[model samples]
Target: ESNRIESINQSIQKKQGVAGCHYFSESVISPNFNVRITLNPDRERKCSRAVLRLAQQFPGDAGAMAPFFLNYLLIAPGESFFMAANEPHAYVAGEIIECMACSDNVVRAGLTPKFKDVNNLVDMLTYSMGGPNIDGGAYSMDNADVIRYSPPCPEFEVMILTVEPGKQSTFKNPGVPVIMIILEGSGAFDGKLCRPGRSYYWPANTDDLIFTVDSSKRGALKVAMAHKNLHLDRPTAINREDFGGASSSNHLNYPTSPRLPYMGLGGGSTPVNEDRRILSVGSKDYAEQGLPSL
Candidate 1:
């Protein structure tokens, strides 16, 4: 404990300078006074005093230092990372395409002037400390024209579609709602001219959506698509006798059939061709129109 406190004090001294340390020492001397010290963001390196304070407060929580275990990820174009729920992560820099479930609940630990819910974050974390799995592998379908990123979560799956210039590709909708974003080159989506920065949300069972890259375009058409993983096949029942007994409670039961309505948007009994009055407007207008009212 003493060694750990010394190590923290040394880091604080190096980052906070003499005046900050003096202020901290004086605050420590006062029983009624709160130790409110801010480190110089420009000078501070390695650990933060705020993080040390959090660690000191919750010595039993191994997840308190989970942020420190983070490894820098240099994600190039067309690369991606999948972060599960309750996984601790922070983007130090750079911008990339991000697809995530619609949830506003955020528990920040540090690296922000906002409220730091350390206790809540520690309690919610997975507590697994290590660099992330950076393998950029995906299942390829249709002669490598389509790449699917099937994360373990049943919520969503991402698909990358590539169409060479003057060529076309057809993707059979998996009977689920989907959203597509054009990443590069120009293309026609179901006969609509779409270029980079264009996005579309298709209702469930859109069936045989086609993408044709314009021959006039110089590069291959790249698009990132996301949709619910509702069509995944699973076994109906488990033969428990092979493992132990049929009456055992540990026997697994997978879904025998596809779900009636998909889990995400447009999951109702709405017909796919019902002309849901889908609008193809600019992003600025879409934002003004709000969330589809569907």
Candidate 2:
């Protein structure tokens, strides 16, 4: 965790200009070892919770998990541990999809990024380790290349559309924002082409989202998407909304994740990218707001 947190510190403090304090001391490194990554301001910072990633109250406190409406992070085959809002994840080797509230309030117990407040993170994280995996029960799409993976989170859900070469999947969902992360082969979000490492955020109230693979590559064009369940008018209808609204009639009421195992490589694993260092980007604001920043 120290190494992981060190990487994040480098990125935020050194790489990016976000973190104001210079946390390059040995005490910060030693105490943060093996702790999950979750950093929030001590109420002295200036920011709104709607736009912030409040890591202070993480998985430990389910009541505090709502404000994070950050990006749907995609950790490729060799990508390092995702930071900020996303936490308690499940990704083992292959590509995976992760979507959560927009805020960067991540609650970590173990994984990467060693924060000084491990006790605080553990106190805020969700005690019950949900499932072992990300989205569960992915069905075959019209195109064999695409498969959708959905996790069972009420506030947000993820859909991984794995597309093969020359194949495309059309999603007609309106009013909700969608984030796409290209994992495997090269593809496009809506119409813009995205490489493996690129991440794109589609604005809310959109009516359509289309993903396509070049069809030249042999692997599937893995696309991970995160969006609000606007199609679901009621709580009981969650199991019935799938593959955009056009195909809602055939939506399967299958129970998603929160029951699967937390899949991912164990600690002391090999770090993937050397050029892109990880850093503790701090927590998103956790203050009160009026509008829903989904």
Candidate 3:
């Protein structure tokens, strides 16, 4: 969790910017809120009751009293929630397909057994009173049975495809790489059977990837994918140095992780560096704002 929190700290401190999304597979209660009140000696105990009962006010197990002063979000099935870099959010319940930039710069304040960095999480949060409107994030395509999630950050984009029986979905790579996974139903991709829970990765500009569901099947094929944002007008050629730097911390999510610029993803693990370096950049401000003149 330190590594996760460190990345978030770096982002909030302007060392790097990171963003992420959660595509719910099942209903759940998660963290996606901001402190609703000013903190004082007794105020923390008298804030909202949601997080108190949901996490605290019971025993030492639920979590902490901090969430009570923050706004909570309820994400339903088929909902994809986007969280920008440096935002304070926590997962409460339910299942979700979470995808973020290839970075673990996160800060975990409370809500889990993992080590909690109260000061860091508190200092990192924006403390904005309200959050995104229901329509703030997410959209779908009219022609194709697909929903695409394009968050505000520059790292990545996501797409959900629902391919009905006998129908096929064709994906043409304009120029970036793509990582895909089968979420439900059986289908054919690149002439091979694609089953649920299986993952597939295709380097940038690979032969047009195609998938189809047979007419005999009763269920439609559902697939979730993430790739470099296709909306940018940048050149196709990728410069390794553009990756900024490497991550010294790694977890199960991507395991060896984003050190792609330094080593092939699956290559032998490299020793973790204590002082990972990157070019200087300002903190992420979703409001199109930057730091006030210093």
Q: Write the per-residue lDDT of candidate 1 for residues 147-227, one digit (tens) a residue.
A: 665544466666778899999888887788889898788888777989889899988866678889868888998888878
Candidate 1 global Cα RMSD: 17.1
Candidate 1, residue 285: how far the Cα is off, in Å? 29
RMSD of 2: 17.4
Distance from true location, Cα of 105 in model 1, Å: 0.8
Computed on alpha carbons, the lDDT of every model, listed in order, comes to: 0.44, 0.34, 0.44
- Return the TM-score for each candidate structure: 0.55, 0.41, 0.57
Q: Residue 271 in model 2: shift from native, Å?
A: 18
Rank by TM-score (best first) = 3, 1, 2
Candidate 1 off by > 4 Å: 1-67, 230-294
Cα distance off (Å), candidate 2, residue 126: 6.3
Model 3 CA lDDT for position 140: 50
How does candidate 2 score on lDDT? 0.34
